[model samples]
Target: MISTYRAVVLTRNGGLDALELRELPLEAPGPGQVRLRVRATGVGFTDIIMRRGYHPDAPKLPFTPGYEVVGDVEAIGPGVTGFTPGQRVAALTVHGGYAESIIRDAGEFIPVPEGLDDAEVTALILNYVTAYQMIHRVARLRAGQSALVTGAGGGVGTALLQLLRVAGVQAYGVDSPPKAGLVRELGATFIDSRERPFDEAVRKRLPEGVDVAFDGIGGDSIARCTRAVRRGGRLISYGFTSAVGRHGGGDNVGGLSGLLALFVGTRLLGRRPSVYGITQLYQKDPSLLREDLSQLFTLLAERRIQPLIAHRLPLLAGRAGQELLERGGIRGKIILLRDVPKKT
Candidate 1:
């Protein structure tokens, strides 16, 4: 008899209902692939877009939507080394992560650092690594600098805020009113985005201008990031949770118009400021994606960065996570399937 494992497969796209938890044959890792017994999976905004069939870069239909996973290696394919069976690990596979078992190249998996729980480490992988790479590698933030983060209390936003605070830089986080405390807890000043304009909100925190702006809101939110920065400051536009499948990419919602606006604004201005969509690390060095994962795992060992728990849901109830993230009530990461492993 074939062994079966549960997986949330996106055979097609539309709503959270598209994610069907069903049985699949559990197979051994192919060459250089590591087979993981998934312990926890993070529900990110990207997954939200992919589930909606929007994100232009999202995988073709009938593919899994999960971007990252935290789990233990149960098997390895030929030529795979540096990891053994039963070793705790986390990976940024970009797909196939929403399953009880997943296979990916060995280079993509990072061993979970000592003293960290699988749930916490899984929560930290993609969002924290993406934020860390942009802030440290791309922005090269300096001490005493100021920064603005849109969606400030979300996974990426919280990570950015925390990193800036640790570097001795002031951070302004734009989030909903209920998340205000969580944003402030990350050592950032919080602004309730629903009630105030982002520029005015951030200005109240930094009367001058901010030095760097990390924007994920991707609609007119880019304009807010624009207004917050001082002359010569850099703006990193990455996510478009609001514009997910729309704008510069294709049909959907918020679109990349926010990004286009930044580019246009740069051209209209005298050219002192630089506005570029992020994906910089991915463009420059894809290997850095894995390296960033490694670095965060190291930080986790030392408690330099911590995971914020918003809510935990079952892998089958991904819609709950999607709703929490979409509603914007949660400040930290939402982890799915706390105790259940997809594979036995």
Candidate 2:
């Protein structure tokens, strides 16, 4: 009999009920591809956005929904090199990661460093890469320059804090009180957005506005973040979790105002603010990935960055994990795990 495995594939989009666990036959890998025995997968808002047909560029209906996976190489196709059977690796999968086995391009895979837990590696890849690219590539802040990050205790925000500290930069984070301690512990000065207006709270500490402003909450908050950036400072716009369901459904989070300000600010300050619709590391520049991953691996090896795992669920329970992510109170990553095969 041919090999077979289970995967979490959505039968449809537009609603949460469409999420279904399905079975599919496993096959040998194509050239430059490897079959991964997926151990863990991270749950991000991108999954939910794609599920709801909100992500403009995502794949069409009835497909597996996961962007990253951690596993061991089960099989390697011809023309592939370096990776061998049972090698621990993490893949920035284009699709099919929420499964017991996945065949993915070798170029997208990275060696999972020894001694780090699977959950940590899974969380680190997506979040840290976005953080690194936005900070080092996009923001390009000078030493001692300060930044204000909204949602500062979330995955990308926390990772940015770690990277910022490494670059000798100071950060002010806006978050709820429950997450204040974690933000402070990450070496960020905290502003409570739930308790006070984001701009007002940020001004109390920053006074003349921060050197950079990193915003994930787009809508109206984008305007506030635009104003908070120093005249010659930068604003890295990355997410729109703020516009998902809560904000009257307008592109309120960093929409037109963000773009207009992004352009106008450049002329006024010489160094202008820019909003990144998506982190381009995966698309425009894949070569930069190896270096970025190596840096993150070094941080992991040195124990300079620690992962906070919010929850882990079975692949079949991916919908539940997405629901937990949508309900929106967690501070870390939710991972989907595959079961180890059982003896007959």
Best of the candidates, TM-score: 2
In order of appearance, the predictions have TM-scores of 0.89, 0.91
Please, what is the whole-model Cα lDDT of each candidate in the order they appear?
A: 0.75, 0.78
Query: What would the per-residue lDDT of candidate 1 be over residues 265-297, giving only the tens digit for each residue?
Result: 744542233433324445466677667777777
Tell me the tens digit of each residue's lDDT in model 2 across 133-175.
7888788877888988888888788888888888788998888
- For model 2, the local distance difference test gives 0.78
| Highest-lDDT candidate | 2
Model 2 TM-score (2 dp): 0.91
User: For model 1, what is the alpha-carbon lDDT of residue 70?
Assistant: 81
Pairs in steric clash, model 1: 100-342, 243-254, 243-255, 246-255, 247-255, 247-256
Clashing pairs in 2: 218-253, 218-254, 219-252, 219-253, 219-254
Off by over 4 Å in 1: 204-207, 245-256, 270-284, 338-344
**Where's the lowest-lDDT run of ten residues in candidate 1?**
270-279
